[model samples]
Target: MAPPLLIFLIMIHGVCSQKENVIYSPSHICALKDSSVIMNCTYTYPTGHQITKVFWTKGPVKGVEPPDLSEDPEYSQRLQYLGDKQQNCTIRLSHVTLKDSHEYYFRFITDKPDVKWTGIPGVTLNVTDLQVESPERVTEGDSVRLTCKSSCTLTDRATFIWYRNSQPLTERRDRNNELLLQSVRREDAGRYSCAVHGHNHISPAVQLNVTYSPRNVSVLITGSGEIVSGDSVTLICSSDSNPPALNFSWFKGGTFVGSGRIYSISKISSDDSGEYKCRSINEHGEKYSDAVTLNIMYPPRNVSVSIIRSCQIWAGGSVTLICSSDSNPPALNFSWFKENESSAVGSGQSFSALQSGRFYCQAHNQHGSQRSDAVTVTVKGHLVILYISIGVVCGAAVIFMMLVWRIRRMKKRNDTHESQMVDSRPPHDRHKACDVELSDPVYENVTADQLDDCKSELDSSVYENLPHNNKRL
Candidate 1:
């Protein structure tokens, strides 16, 4: 007996001195449907402690477990024994689903701890239902709120997060473990989901469906409220929508006027005047705006012509003729025309009248056309009259010169005639003129000196009669 006691004590001491074999694996797993998953667990004991039995068991409904070798009927087929007698205690599960998801308890029986068991921490398996929800719609300038609820019961304090079209939103506390939004905008409208984290597991997401009416619907005018004939005008309709989808239509005088986002009047006329309205439609509903009136005024009103200057203008004098009218958008074209001419003068509102004529102006716009009351431009002919008067004065001056020359010639002739008359009278006084002469005339020599003169004359006469005349007498 003493020898047997010593052997037992040695055996116990040896057993206690040997190190235990230990194994460890993951105690929790998360997977998706139709996917594979691994459950990790390990055990510890002496080197010769062969792993006799290794199997997984699901939790009993609420709480009961049998202590004997009889297997629980519910986990018979799904349970897998992964560890062999020597090593490897991890398990792998295939074709996972929500129904197969639960807490699994790993039980291992070793040869050294006969009839006893080594169990690791139970692992909770989570099978997620990953799916996307349909997108939502929201109008411009309106407010919306979306909520994402979880399909699982999250008892532990969990963090809830939201996503828009796959982008993560700010995390939220787990009061209800739901994603929430306040005053959502058009840009916030899109695919949304919620993620819940609790009990070291994530719950499946819940989708939020949001729909709203169109907002900020408005109509814009390209021009003023008053339009004219032959003028171009544009009316634009705009609004905000979810999915960026919208239909725009225009109406005039309670009747459908045009299609598309903009309604254009190529040639606006007086007949185009009426009340205009715009309507925006979406999947949510339709919205109509208040009507705006379009009063097409006469092309131009009160067309009149004004003469800027009327002084005695020279041939090159500049005179301005102004054509004026009242119209919206100003008159595009202003032209001056002679009463019966085929061409237009001056391409603008005012024209310089260089030539003399009767001129009129025309003011035109898209609404209509107007002709100014005819204006008569009487270019003064004073210059021509002045030229004529200067010619007449020059002709008068030439006639006066000719008359004075004729009078001077007559005066010279009269003086010559008077001198000849005086000469004819001088003949009676010719004897007196001879007495005054310095020399005697030949007829005055007959007065002799005495009778001797006569005797001598006789003797001379006798001598003269004889050939030589006797000088001796």
Candidate 2:
């Protein structure tokens, strides 16, 4: 019985000598910058026990004794008594800079004589500079990558935040901490930075130098073909770049010609014809475009003016005043000027003006421009009057001939009618004498003398022929 009782007493003594309970508010060491930071700890003791005193201390440095809350005068101003004997314990450091970086330990006591607790190898605080990384230049329609690396070894888990042009970006984990810009455009070309949030500490800014050249460069001419002298011509150069173009220059015949995107030649001439080039430059690099050539041909010549007539155009008849000029490569423009007003005409060799007056034409080609000598067109109004008079005279002659033909026809009809009338009239008494006349003539007045003559003639003949005819039986 005595041996058993002695063994129980030793067991009770072993239980009473066990260590007190303690737990830190924040189990991990936190980092901070030149700003505020919070540290906390919590613990649980036997139910009957109550807290009496509580304090905080710094871990032992080198071989020196750990800081004591009751005796240390140097830490008094900086130290805080945040622990509640009955509830919780936490510490806050304000205006914390690099110098405040150190391990913090806590100590506590309870009203029950057997209960006591102390912090179990507590946390360490580190203050560091903010992190900053920025890109210098970015081009339009390009993807950009920026990386933000920790200057110091970031032992704890940290969050990285990215920014572009001072605007906040999405936060991400420390690993794979690069900001990726998908299909970056000109608007994305600006300063970029990253912020590291770990243990409540932010790092300093870091700059990234990025560069790219112009893209999609193009050249355009306002008008194609040969540019005439004394005519303004424009050549336009365009490109896609960030921060806009720094400089634009034009070259002709391998020599710098102008200082703007649109190079204008106030008076284009044959001398202006050459291989023209344009170059655009930015902070990134220089870009050159393909060259174009201008061809200047011969000036206009053989300027002649005339009037166009249709049929027998009399005075007051409308006619066209024509001016023509010959030029190589054809004329680019033809203008008709009347009075003080000028209007552009067709590009053909001739131009016409309907309203005749003092008029002329000017022709232009790539080489030069020419103006014809002015001519005055005199329109005769009396010719129309003469034509009308001649027409009237000819019409009268035709009418006179027609009247004579009608009169002759009427006379012939009248003569035919009279002849018919005379033929139709009855024959008179001449016809009655025919039968009686024949009866009266039969009674002879053949008288005696005629008989005597007949006898005598017969007698002579008888005497002569007496012998011949004796018998007259």
Error of 2 at 335 (Å): 16
Cand. 1 Cα-lDDT: 0.60
lDDT leader:
2
lDDT of each: 0.60, 0.61
Q: Candidate 2, residues 1-473: lDDT per residue as tens digits? A: 34777755544332212334455545555454545566776655667766677777776566664556435655456556566775567766666666666777666677876565555566667756555544555555567677766434444555677766666765434455577777776555556666665334444444443445777777788886656656788889998765468699988867887887888777776667789888999877788888887775568887766777764355444556666777667776777666465565434545444444677777777766788887775556676688788889999999967865765565466447645654565533222221222124331222222223224334454434333222221
Which 10 consecutive positions of candidate 2 have the poorest summed lDDT?
429-438
lDDT of 1 by residue, 1-473 (tens): 34777755544322222243233344445665555567766555556566676666666343454232126544444445566555566676666667777776555566765543434235678776444333344444445544443334422344555566666665544455344456655455556665554222233434444456666777888865556567788988877654343588889978897888888898777678889989888877888877877877666878999998745354345578888998765798998898899799777988887768889888998766788888887655676577678789999999967865765565466447645654676655643433332123321221122112224324344434432212322
How many pairs in model 2 have backbone atoms within 3 A of each other, for residues 3 or more apart or on separate chains, i.e. clashes?
15
Per-residue lDDT value at 433 in model 2: 28
